[model samples]
Target: MKRFLVAPLVVALAAVTLAVLPGSPAAAALIDARVGALTFRPDAPGTGARRLASASVRQDLYLDRVSGTFVLDAEPVAGTTSYLRVTFGHLDAGRSCQGDLELRTDTTSPSNGFTRSGRTLRLVATERRFGYQDWDCAFAVLDLDTNGDASDGSVRSVLIGELTDVPARPVLAVTGVQLLDARALRLVRGVWTTIEVTVANRGRADAARVVLRGSGRGVQVRPTPVGVVRDDDDTTVQVRVRLTGKRATTLRLTASGGGATASRSVRVARAKAPARPRPGTYRSADGDTTFSVSGGKIRGFRVRTTTRCGGYPDIPTTTYNTYSFRTVGVPRNGIVVAKEKGRLYTARLQLRIAGGKVTQGRFSYAGPAACFAVERFTASRRR
Candidate 1:
């Protein structure tokens, strides 16, 4: 069997463009964290300086638009042990760099065909001296597939998941899900596989909104959401996933790649949209009447409502537990309300104060049928 990886080179234009484009329109926007900045260190015991001389090699790695194909320059990190730790970090907008991944050497060559197992990337080394007894050598690829800032997170914390089980007992992960309107897709069931990914975004200002695409014997994940993380002024990255088996099906999760790309260490069991109005106080203009809030507390309610479905049309169906209040500086405990066509609502409003001559205040609400529960007492702050 022959390995087929291109030589790894220094940073290329593709990487540079993604990293150094702050004056452009995307400047004010989110730059891809994976290509933000990059840092890869060669760690060896103090005694292995001899091996270091033979392996101090550099490579230019290019990630495809979808985070799948990667082209490494035709060179190896100079001489030495087959077990050197290769770390790849992401860089955000500035040139600030950070570590992203560390690969273990098994049967490494100029060209390598990598296999993915669950969330791990595996490559068998032909050199048996590296001590890999199996038919092939293995390495893990870390892909967080999230949306925030990767570099913003500390190196120790960000790469914690990646650091833990480098020599992992491969497990399949649901990298992405593509909902097929096709009737055939609906008939399929559970299947799995692994994915090696690298993202490329035309614009470096933000994480590219790209999705992962995969095909299985039967089953699929529909519209997987990817989070963006900005790290390493070198926000550029390459990640891999392990997926379980499904019937004949295809699943995809899109993300901005390259300067637009964002990668991280992620663990996903499964994702699904949450249900509405399962068990909570509800207020609605038109729906099945279920629950309500009453008493003075519901009247002095002072909290923002979310169930934010949309605009006015959404408001009528909003299960927001609206309450009115008279006195400020009172501790208000909020609750969940389902959107239902009802008359009154319920709430609990609390007021804390020390012993003193207290003034009487009033509470009132003139909206549709509003109700509340009110309780007053003195709560001394801990000394």
Candidate 2:
């Protein structure tokens, strides 16, 4: 790490004579004094090329009735040396002095040239070293002493400062996208669907904000605004789209931030008309078995027996057993068939009905049981 040593002349240059001459005028007495220091480091390991750490220091000094302030600012310069600027405020008695400086590397002292314009002093060094490392740098500010004897003047006070820069470029990428609504699979014309797009920052810098844009032929798409995304972090935004064409369409979405952009696409097809089933409660001729059909599918069923079929055991002879079935295909000609397949058993059922009533049906089951059978029965629709 960079180190700074800021000490008053009275404490640092005690060997220098400050005594009054017996036959001459009295020497100026030491009064109030202050010292400060600063250090800067890279924000990240690989970011040193584009960014730097920042630091500053301030001090107040008083001599008798006079008071003054000193401020230091420091920062790293891209592809160049570190820069330091010092400002002097409310100098005592309005006194002005030129600043000379040296850059210290261990025991070796190298002169780092400086210039003073008005009350500000500036220094630049080719070695951009700071923080703890094998080698460190220190800056020393020097000036002529109050004593008329030039040979007696020596090091008096010191101060420190630092600066850092942030990465200049940002890289954005779209990592993944997903459709939020189940309707995305059956996208009908003139209907809207929700989609989620995830964005990530793959660069070394953070993005303060990201903007999303979406477009597609034969569809209107809108995207939600995404806020900040840090380096190596990701965020998701919502995109809503409505299909307006009769054919399949592709929707493209783009995420842009900090001069970087990424895009993703999704394909949607026009929906087909759903099969319509005769909707009503259906029952078998024995009245001990029943089925409910809705929206062109066998939605529910009940059976009375001692044997288990398709992982479902038959109900007691006094009661009916009920369970649900999944539709696997479109209904045809007022006939709806459904099936339930499991590791232990598989079942198939075909129901023929019309005018909101069941006319006839067949239910079959196959499993490890040797007595597996198919039963054909006639049904009557409930009034």
Q: How far is candidate 1 from the true structure (C-alpha RMSD, Å)?
A: 22.0
Task: State every prediction's TM-score relative to the real structure.
Answer: 0.19, 0.30
Model 2: per-residue Cα lDDT at residue 170? 56
Model 1, position 220: C-alpha lDDT score = 40
**What shift in Å separates residue 242 of candidate 2 from its native position after superposition?**
1.0
Cα error, residue 51 of model 2, in Å, equals 34
Highest-lDDT candidate: 2
Residue-wise C-alpha lDDT for candidate 1, range 108-151, written one tens digit per residue: 33123344332232333232222221111111112121222223
lDDT of 1: 0.26
- Worst ten-residue run, lDDT, model 2? 129-138
lDDT of 1 at 204: 25
Give stretches of model 2 more than 4 Å off. 1-168, 180-186, 273-383
Q: Report the backbone clash tally of model 1.
A: 126
